[model samples]
Target chain A: MSRLKVLLPSARHLVTEELARGVVERYDEAAVGEHTVDFERRLDLGGFDDAVSAVMASHDAGDLSMDGAMAEAVHRQLRLSRREAADPGIWRYLAIVHRPEVVRHRWEYRSFATMRTRFWRHGTRFDANAFSRWWWVAELTVMAEDYSLTHRALGSSALSTHLFSRQLAWHHPTVAACVRILADAPGADVERTLRVLGKMLGLRVAEAMGREELEGLVRAARG
Target chain B: MDDFGTDGLTGGEDEDGTHFRALCKDTLFSNKREEGAGGSYGLGKSVLWIFSSFSTVLFRSTLLETQGLGNPRLIGRTELGSHALGPKRAFQGPGWFGEETKQRRGTRAESVWGPAAAEISGALGFQARNDHDTGTSICVVGFKDPTADADLGPVELARATRAALAEYFWPSMALPTRALTARTEAAGQEVEVRPHDADVAPFVTAWESYLRGEVPAKAPLTKPGDMTVVEVPITIPRTHGGEPEVKGRVALVVRLAAKSSEPRAGQVAFFRGPGMVVSYRDRSRLALGMRPFHAVLACGRGRWPRKPTESDLAVESFLRMSEPPAHDRWEPTPRLKAHYRRGYAKALTELSRRVDEALKELLIATHVMGERGPERLQRRFPIGKAGSPGKGRSAFGMSGLDARPQDGAWSFSGAIERKAGEGPWSVQVRLAEVDEAGRRTEEVAIEALSVTVDAEVVVEGSVASVTVPADVRVVPFRGTSAPCSFTGALELELAGRMVAG
Candidate 1:
């Protein structure tokens, strides 16, 4: 049986935000709200716990950076489908109730404001919560079955931010194509290209485009 | 009802006339209340008129604030839904009762005072209280119950009122400091409603235990009256307007009910520091095999165990402002938004989340507390790492040596390599989709494909099969994934089966 379940009404709202802000304050206790049971499958917390511990130890042990590693670890252990990855609540439960210590250890307790957004927030805010941010970066950049591209997309914080910030980059194939451009055009202004491309993608529906058309747009932006 | 009436309704008084005007006005005109006062919104006073079928209510009070005018004061107010007193004359709505005034230029109506007020109060069958005691007596001329049949006798009304008071005000009735004492009269027989009454006992015990510090944090609740407290966090955000972020907590008080059919079971009463029950949340459906229980989600300064800090006060303010006009729920209200920034809405959800989360802890069985997820859920999800490329992935075959999107299709080209003394193998490749719920969609059609290899290829709905001759040292292969439109993310599932050498 899966020990993990997704919080329904999948958006950021009251119970979700309270769970977020109170994540550190009431980290050990489960949130008081409705959650999926039999209809929505549960997740196993054991392997996830192990993965989280490995990341935390690695970060504390120094050397091998754990951002991408944790991203890979969570992605591998969680194995959430693309749709499950989109729900900010699961990331909230994962970070807050499931493994808040890792979030605190990784993100650090800056302030309650940071804690609020890092746990849960309203609107198209996948970037705020610590777990969702990394999970999404991996999801958008990983090729067919390879996470190597995912590692490269997260190679540097700046590179990851530039790619992650763009709406077009949220489209998996478009980001995969853009990430390849980042690897190819070594000296190019990757940030400027992606930013300009994001504005353009915002004007158009990027999801409807295939990889070839998206790559063409990425190459055009390189000019 | 027993004593203490310092503030009284004063007429013809300039400075403290709010008491008189607000009580006998068109609608409740009093919106201002000092922080942590036992009243709010002023909408509560209207309940007297609402419960009265005559739309009329009479108030008689002994004076302390208005002692200069006289000893006792009597007044009446009615709120009628615009009706015709006679055939031609129409009355807009509200009207007052007391004395006809010649000095006041506006409405001739005014509160009656002194010996006449006392005589009239007695004639109206009002309960007699000590003359020196300062308080107001409100008589709703003909009380109404929308759900009840016609008119209930005084005894039934008294019994129902007692039960309600016990259910909602058990904490106040049980307090060690003596917050309030209530008595109900039925059929000319008066009975004191104690905290130990059937409807009130469980909650009273919870409050008594909590106040006595018998059950604090994480205490086990084994028997009846045993309780536990969980502090749920409510953090208010800082805005561009420069209010610094404030962090606070709402203490969740949960008590184990004595039996399954207890009236308040699976219900939670939420209140603030003012010590009044604000609302009751029904959680009956959420309770599973857990013990039947009632809970109290106490917030603000009044409910704080010790002296409240600055942050605690801020939390109280946050919650108070968030309350709607009904004051029954803590949600993002216009007043709350006007005071705080836009993002404070999360606090409401946080509160709701805490209520359920706290219940999950208290109501669910202790055995299931540490129990992990359901059976066989630990297996790797099929998309990400299931058929994913990995180190020491001894699934012997050149499946996806290189894979990329080519000409709007997934192009997979790899050579089939096997060591000497190895058998010929059959390779299977399938394209699958993940549904909205993160589960893989059932395998559909994948035959709209292009296959290029020096071997025979067979196509099934979502799977592709290829057989390679054992003699070939290495066979180069290339193929396009699909022409079938798949909406969600797709993953390629690959498998290899050894034939014979």
Candidate 2:
């Protein structure tokens, strides 16, 4: 297997707003692909470009949902440690250099303002980036190398946004219990149930609560 | 490690090179350092020797100019504390390597140069410098820093060293003019340390915001990632100069961290010209429940929006002179009398005080009139007199009346409300149990009365006299009902009257 080396983020790696604009105004994968990045060392040793391409291809064919698949693809292919994943630079490099075609295809030829944050933005790493949010979702939801839970959570767009869009995602087990219960309870009105639970959980220490207790509270709120 | 040539060993020949003598001989004094340089007290070099278990260090420096016989110089020094050699003999306890010269009083040593320096450096396994490079490298022969860590091994020590370097100098490394790159090796494996490492990523974001000039000039922080820039003006009173005062401003860049997980979230990285962090002051109390934040107080050349002028340099020197031998904090020391006029300390105090005021403006939510919800809730209570029938037409009255009868006494509680206009309510409450003939049975002593508004509450014997602000419509009060001795039918035996004045 071939290992891929990545660059440490620097001014040279800056994907200027102009470059993102170019990607939008004139859709040129070749111009985006031709930009070279100087790699320092192998913090991310995964050779997963093929995996990313396969998902985008399948998504275009309507064979699979994009979000859950892309999330699983990133988590499975990158194998990023928690330390490496925290850096927005790595995700920026991946979105711009390694998989520009995929990012462009995923978000499509929209306004530069809309597409700019999908690639790079300062201080919005967790929420703004297309690849980072997916990987973090998988990382935060996965149970001991199990991506099954992540799929269940990301399977629903409203559930993911309602739960993980806020700081409540940091309380992993609380989020996990909510995802588990909401995923199982049919017609649970995920948004309405979660809105009520989000307020009640704020008053209590959700992190310290057990899975069963949180699930029970969530289940009760569904009623 | 060799990256030397342009600024190699200086033998203190030229005035610009006098820091060489100061580094070796003077313990706590600074040579005439360049403006915006760090190490004001020149004590950082001592850490090299102090970190070593044997109090010894080796050096190899490439020079741009030299007073010695040859170019790059090599030396070794050891500082064993002052101790005795024999019964009555004592040694000052500092030893040096190189050529010894007979001075006017005794003997002294100087660093070796050229072939001799190369020979010693090669024997100690020091790397060769490129012909174009210029810098100095020192090796703590028996390296150990108990305070940094309890006996860290090569890898752990290297990691700790890299972390400290990145943590303190992260702002410098993240800035557009970043000039430093640090690389470390342990057991033949090299790790390049960068500022955007996960541990310092938040700080890097904060410094990047400052460098990008993303700070807004006003209040009410819009989002978590928003930052506000405030100028902390520092005016130094000069002892003797062309100008009587040096006016300069340092930018205090305060940014709310994007997440609560940001390390050292509530600390303001305090530093001066060299951009080495002197302290991380905890100002978390300023905005108690606001989102965790990271701040940078850049003084001296690190000031933003402009380059450091000659006046800024003068203020930098004044602030540097105010620091103690440790250089950990800047303050008005007794030593300031030599360099600054009277009341020079006020600028330093203002610099510290300005940080709190600026942060509060950005993070602390200000009180807006009529915005508080509790005031609106107070208006919902119906206006009536406390301990009276619902028939008082006064401008201010009480409502939500509750007089719990237990053990032949009443535990009274109610909310005071405004009926008409703005003024004070001078009201009196009486507690007594009445008989069927409308006669007083027993007096219920007024133990305690608490009004939420600022008022003079005088509880004399069994009656309570109180005054409250008419604008504050809600004042929920409750007091203890003393154990009573009058035993009777507690149903229709309670009588109370609230007198309005």
Candidate 3:
């Protein structure tokens, strides 16, 4: 398994002109390599571009209907190919150098200040990077060869938001999968169902249950 | 909020206050104007709406009417995502926070919250201005947690707000007028925002000095060195007709330190009218020898309109045609390109030339060149001798040369010698060869015979010897000549002054 380490900013300061200028001037690809934990598995720029283009095409064609699933698949595929090079620095490089145009295209309508954060920072928080969120959501929710369920869950905003935003809820894949299955059922009110499950599961239940037990709990919540 | 008490929330009724309308609505590109004075794009004001959890903000303004009477107004507006309420019903999210006004001549009736202006103002702790006071105040309701990390309550949000105000509007604070003052209420204590604090003292000082038409002697993060200031003239071509020329000045500060801690040292900030910094150019790309330096250029206010009229707007629009939407960078328009060529580029080149000259003079005055004298000489004059010949034979029977059975066989040697009481000097000997056609074809170096000469003596023999100096470097011959060949007669000539034995 490839582990990507991300360094959060020491302080949550606004990105100023001086800060932006400093970051731009000091950024060096070689320096990034030196700091990377996996130096040997550096991402090939051409391959990254090709993968990005393919994902963007699928996004534009509406083939990737579930934003959550699309985010997951892109993250999983990109990470799987270059497992060793999975680091926050690489993601930053990708956001700033490789595909800033695509990010801007998707998010220019929002405030410029908000857009700056999406393009600069990384993590799994509310204002974490737009790209990192997709990668992380996919990494946590999708099991081996069961991306279809992840897609269905992501299509429902209630399930996906709860899964992605709450760290404890999504860490247990069985519980997450059961929630997705219940949300996908006919005549199910996803928002209310998620609210109830959220209260019942809490943090302790999420921590304690394995796949089978979590699935049973999810069924009991449904009942 | 208490410092300028009694001043109304609005500047005045007669003043052009429509600029604040952009802030009231969540409209994209609403403030695009021909002139750069107004908002380039309306997205900047959206930060206020984004900060509110409900995407709502309240505006309260007390204005002086035509009769100089105080008229306070309050309004609430929100911008929610589409389909937030339901699929069919969408809220416009605008409401007056006071009683509705009755219809009058040339005006329609409007609905407002049912409360007296004074009551509302007092209830919200918005100090009501006396008859003379006029200004504006906005309250963003239900502020979202601005913290990027864990939720830290309202204190973190207050700090973030103060920091943002300080960083983005430091230039405004540095102005003589002190254009804006921000205060925050956290933990029941109001704290004033002071962007001109010690952390950014250099920028503050530079800005103040720039406004006073004086460039500081030192750059932001460099020790004092040679500083040069020059005035550059700029001409803005009017879109409609006339051309206005503005005088700008460029100040270059050479740092005393060899390395600079300030990353912005080599950048030149370009200020527009009223000493407002619009953008910066990295003039370090000029390949100037002086790396630890900073330059600043400011255009006089005479170039821009003090209060924009229609005609002035045309000029401003024309002047800023090439400016980006954020006004953070200058794009290349034909007019701007011409201005750059005439003003910016010329000033930078001249400053760089002066810096180069000053650095060279400093190096020479400090005797730094003496340390590199030997290396300089070695590079300029390579220590070697050259000859053109097919072959040569040693007359003294030296090891590597065949002893030619000829009438005239010549050999020469040259070396650089340093005497104890004299500077280093070069000594060389050359022998010329003459062919049957009576033309000199080649020259060869002959070996000098070793001999100890206690006094000046002309030694005539097959083996010529010179006394060896304490430290001497023989100049090796660098010529493509064969070891054994005799073409013509050989004549020996020795050059350079001889040292006393």
Give the C-alpha interface root-mean-square deviation per candidate: 11.7, 24.8, 51.5
lDDT for model 2 comes to 0.63
TM-score-better candidate, 1 vs 2: 2
Q: Which stretches of candidate 1 lie over 4 Å from their true place?
A: A1-223, B1-6, B10-17, B80-93, B104-107, B176-186, B222-224, B238-243, B257-263, B282-292, B305-309, B359-501
| lDDT of model 3 at position B446 | 45
- Tens-place lDDT per residue, model 3, A80-185, is 5325334555465455544554454344334556656765666654345656656665666567756655566556555665555553444646546555466566
* Model 1: per-residue Cα lDDT at residue B323: 74
lDDT of the candidates, in the order given: 0.63, 0.63, 0.45
Q: For model 1, what is the alpha-carbon lDDT of residue B290?
A: 62
Candidate 2 structure quality by residue, lDDT tens digits, B1-501: 334233655665224446466666566666757766676667777887888888888877777766446656777778877755478856577777666777787766677778878778878877777435556778788887758636777777777767877878876666554545444555566665576775656666767777777766543344566666778788878674445777887778777776666677778888777777777888877654445778888777777525777766776777777777777788778768766777688888987888887776566432111111233222221122122332234344445555555665556676555544333445565555433222344556777777777766788886677655435555566665567633322211112111111
How well does model 3 score by local distance difference test? 0.45
Clashes of each: 18, 8, 13
User: What TM-score would each prediction reach against the true structure?
Assistant: 0.47, 0.48, 0.39
RMSD of each: 27.0, 27.8, 31.9
Q: Can you give the lDDT of residue B184 in candidate 1?
A: 48
Tens digit of per-residue lDDT, candidate 1, span B1-501 = 333545666554234436666666636556345455445567777788778888889988876766566767888877866756479756666676779776644444678888788888889877776656776777888778767877777777777777777666666656555444444454556676665866656666776777777766866565676678888888877744788988878778888777769887888888776666778888867755567888887787745646766777777777777777777677887777777876689878877887797787566542101112222221211323443243333435443344455566656555555433243556666665443233454443444434454566777766777776655545556656665433344445545544421
Error of 2 at B118 (Å): 1.5
